[model samples]
Target: MARQGRKPKGRPVSGWVILDKPKGMGSTEAVAKIKWLYFAQKAGHAGTLDPLASGMLPIALGDATKTVPYVMDGRKVYRFTVRWGAETTTDDTEGPVTRASDERPAREAVEALLADYTGEIEQVPPQFSAIKIEGERAYDLARAGETVEIASRLVQVHRLDIVDVPDGETTVFEAECGKGTYVRSIARDMGRDLGCFGHIVDLRRIAVGAFDEEDLVTLDELEDAAQEGREPLDEAAIAAGAKARVTDFRPLDDYILDPATALCDLYEVTLSDDQAGRVRSGNPVLLRGRDAPAFCDEAFATGQGRLVAIGSIEEGSFHPKRVFGGRH
Candidate 1:
């Protein structure tokens, strides 16, 4: 695809990179490699995958980094294979085999257990994780051979479909879950619940937020493209990837949706230009736009049908809390 827009010159570059990460490389390694290729001073990945796992990993550069947290709030999907009868310290193949069992549940039995994992469930994160415990990273504590008790957090497993159940001691599963759901923990928990210890042997992320594996460009492909003077940031190339899905996709001249478009479906209150300017200036504005008996003391303002600013009414004025679409 032909490169769109002018080639940037020392200006801070901002865009998303959906990397089809290769195995044996950690998520941070992939980010570092891409950052070197782009010469981006700032970059971050929305979610992380184990070195043994590979697939859609969204790498946000420059200003795109600001949107990383928002993007990460979306659901994720993974296709992974679990080896039954073995439990690992890290819950994946990378960990040492801490325990083993001879029991192998039938395929029917495994499918029955999947149903119990669907919907909202409580899950404890793995010990080798970034979660902090008493101000120190859990992984740090784990590496120091310290036992840390991590609290269980509630997460939703939107869907858990059994992809394949081979006669051997391995079972393959495809699951869609909300943010913060740990697949490794699920694998370990499944083995325990099924009367057999288990550990993830192979795992591949199919989707992160709206980006899918099919849309990712492998590192080799990207290198070849770069060598051929193909810039993935080109509009055509980006449009073909996951960045296009959640992006505005529309021309700026066209009416811009409120930056809060994702939250538009929820309760909202409109404001006039004068009121919007006041709210933008840190004044508290009332939610008089809606006549259905104002349900909230908090009021938000919109300009040109897009959420321009949000604020809470205090003593008859709305003080702006967040302003979107403005040059930050």
Candidate 2:
């Protein structure tokens, strides 16, 4: 019997592409599009963005996929609009209106209810959701006309603010919340409390973890930059000095973020070349730096400004869990 390392076909491009997904595009479709554009061997997205929602979708290619969970669990910011007087089955404009109301909430009423939604709260997800139920997707059952009782979950909403009362029928809101917080649920529940049924007319995710809306690369921008297809990358090129790392990836356009960009929230340990070499080889190393933590549940290590590995630190020693190959 023989064992060998797995080698990826195609260019082993790796990095985070913070896509500003346009409305009506699905998260999976966006990920696939990026993968095709970069010709990456592996790719995945951190969070799910609905087909109708638009904004920051952090897509990880190759080694960056390892950091997906950390970014997905991080805080998110959304700017959404809710239309009063009708609640839909899906809690958004795409679904049929299930409840209608002649009543509309006042600006003061909406603002007062903001505090009620803030902090830890119980939220019922929309009927049309990806959540699983008895081995089936909730949305599939919903679309097939089968009614299922969806359980409510505890989610944290750090802050909610009424950005504008655009009209008597619509209100724009901005929310900063922890993972699993649904903007649609907020609209539905707030409407019930205000005595006016509501549904989301527009939803946009402005940020996820370390990525901000300002860091977004639009779909149009990406396609425009790729008029000339990407150049072949040696997998290890990202760590091969600054100039090659910049010019070798693609055109002069700044489309990709560092693979470690999604790891900003993690505890970081800067390592020496020798230690990095050991870490890259799947070995543990003592955290000899003066600022090293005695213990940490999760942390990432970097050497010579290149990502080395992500692991946990126990008793002043860093254990390599998912090690990055080919330098960066």
Candidate 3:
């Protein structure tokens, strides 16, 4: 028998990739392309963008996948076009025409409808969505010609701006909302309020969490850059795309941001060198001088020390979740 090679050791390549997803491609396809490009051992996207939408899709690689859910829970902003006169089964252009109306609401009427969605409201997700139905995906159920009735959930629309009326019928609007707020659902509700039926003809997510469209690199651009012997995709390039959302940790001299920057938004607790070492060893460290709130899991250093770990405080001590550095 041939000699077997030894398994590789140490950590694998890990980071985040912010892709400017193109229209007509599913989120899974984008993730696969990136995985192939980097030859990553593991990869996952923070959120899913519809085939009709194009914009920032944050992909987490290696250990960064553990932090994806925390990033995905952040706010998102989108610019979408609502076409008056018809509604689709999926609420976007992907589905068949389920309803139609000849009444075209005036531009002002559409603007008025925006107010109704400005605050918290219940939203019924479209049938052709990724939502699970009795352990199966809702979209799968819908495609199989099965009746799927998804429950309505409350979502917040922080800001809804009517950017332009762009004629008498269509409305171009920008929305900043919490996670799970579907722009297509907004379009459908707006139509109902305006005494017309509408559906999203074009949808583009401009921002997700702190990542923005400006930081996005298109698939074509990334491939072109790779072919020209330019910079290859790596953890650093991937981290750059997620930089906008990461909080600034450098006090003044240090300028480079790492993947840990993503945790900067959380309230920080400084630890001494001894305390940090213990924390990295997975011990609970008691914090002082701060009344840390729940969900704040980050910790900084007191001197020229490195961040040791992220921990949750309970019973007056911090229990480490992730460890980075030790006494130095």
Candidate 4:
């Protein structure tokens, strides 16, 4: 039998698919569906999104998967609603109630407490979380009826604001945070401090790194595209066209973002034939040209707008760390 998942099969399609994940779909499930729909040889998601949450899950295909870490390290923004009366075992609606309260906090009180949650704060993740404890998943242990001591770690909450309070039962909040910040932890802790136990009733991730809500494509859209025969062009074809300077060819599906799209956050250095050749060969070269980006610790090089490598600039020289072989 062929080694499973060792060699990916199908088209070598490479790009980012910004999925508007539905509330019931897990991140892995979404990635699997995308892989099937696109017939991609390789696929992976930038970050994990809980089944209870929805929106903007970035899935990288083929060579795009090489840039997954960059997207994973980027900031995340979410809008979530917290039920004001109880805290759950999982910190969200899927779990049973662990604590309850009758006192609902006022809007003014919630607003006043927002500042305290902003900036860097220590947070303890919920028991039903992915954190590892002695090489075992915390969630796995919790599910097995084991109690584990989870440590609190600092997470950056760039901004946290109350979006609305539709009723005394729930309060909506929009939070912009760095990687590792948990929206569920925010709701759980806030409730305890406010003396009104709470849990995440609804959650949606609106943005991650270079992607945002506007870039999302629903599963229904993917199904429609598949049915209509709309799909990303083959990577081999794209490579051949690039060599022939054929920039006119466009993918049948316009929704597939370029692999370079993930590097939009980095400084860009357009390379000449010689410079690009050196970068592609895993060699460093002195960067030149009026369009060369300013000195930066990290940047990406492109030839004719196609990604060559992600590198660093030091003493006007670009050193390739991760080469893309000039793939489109």
Candidate RMSDs in Å, in order, are 9.2, 6.5, 8.1, 7.3
Report model 2's TM-score to 2 decimal places: 0.90
- In model 3, how large is the Cα lDDT of residue 304? 35
Q: Score residue 121 of candidate 1 by CA lDDT.
A: 95
Identify the candidate with maximal lDDT: 2
What is each predicted model's overall lDDT from 0 to 1?
0.72, 0.87, 0.73, 0.86
lDDT of 1 by residue, 133-221 (tens): 98999888988999899999999999998899776789899999998898888999999998898999888888876566555767776
- Model 3: lDDT equals 0.73
- Cα lDDT tens digits, model 3, 100-143, are 89899987677667778988999998888888888999989999
Q: What are the per-model numbers of colliding residue pairs?
A: 7, 0, 0, 0
Candidate 2: segments with Cα more than 4 A from true spot: 1-7, 228-249, 326-328
Which candidate's TM-score is highest?
2
Q: Mind giving the per-residue lDDT tens digits that candidate 2 earns over 253-304?
A: 3587777888898898999999999998898999886788999998999987
Model 4: per-residue Cα lDDT over 1-328, one tens digit each: 8866666466777889999999999899999988877777789999999998999899998889999999999999999999998999999998889899889999998898899899999999889888999999998999999988999999999999988889989999999999889889999999999999899999999999989888999988777666556435578977777322212223324668878888878998888988889888999988777766546898988888788889899878899998885132
Worst 10 residues of 4 by lDDT: 243-252
Candidate 4 runs further than 4 Å off: 1-8, 230-252, 290-295, 326-328
Q: After superposing candidate 1 on the true structure, give the runs of residues whose Cα lies further than 4 Å from its correct spot.
A: 1-10, 230-328
Candidates ranked by TM-score? 2, 4, 3, 1
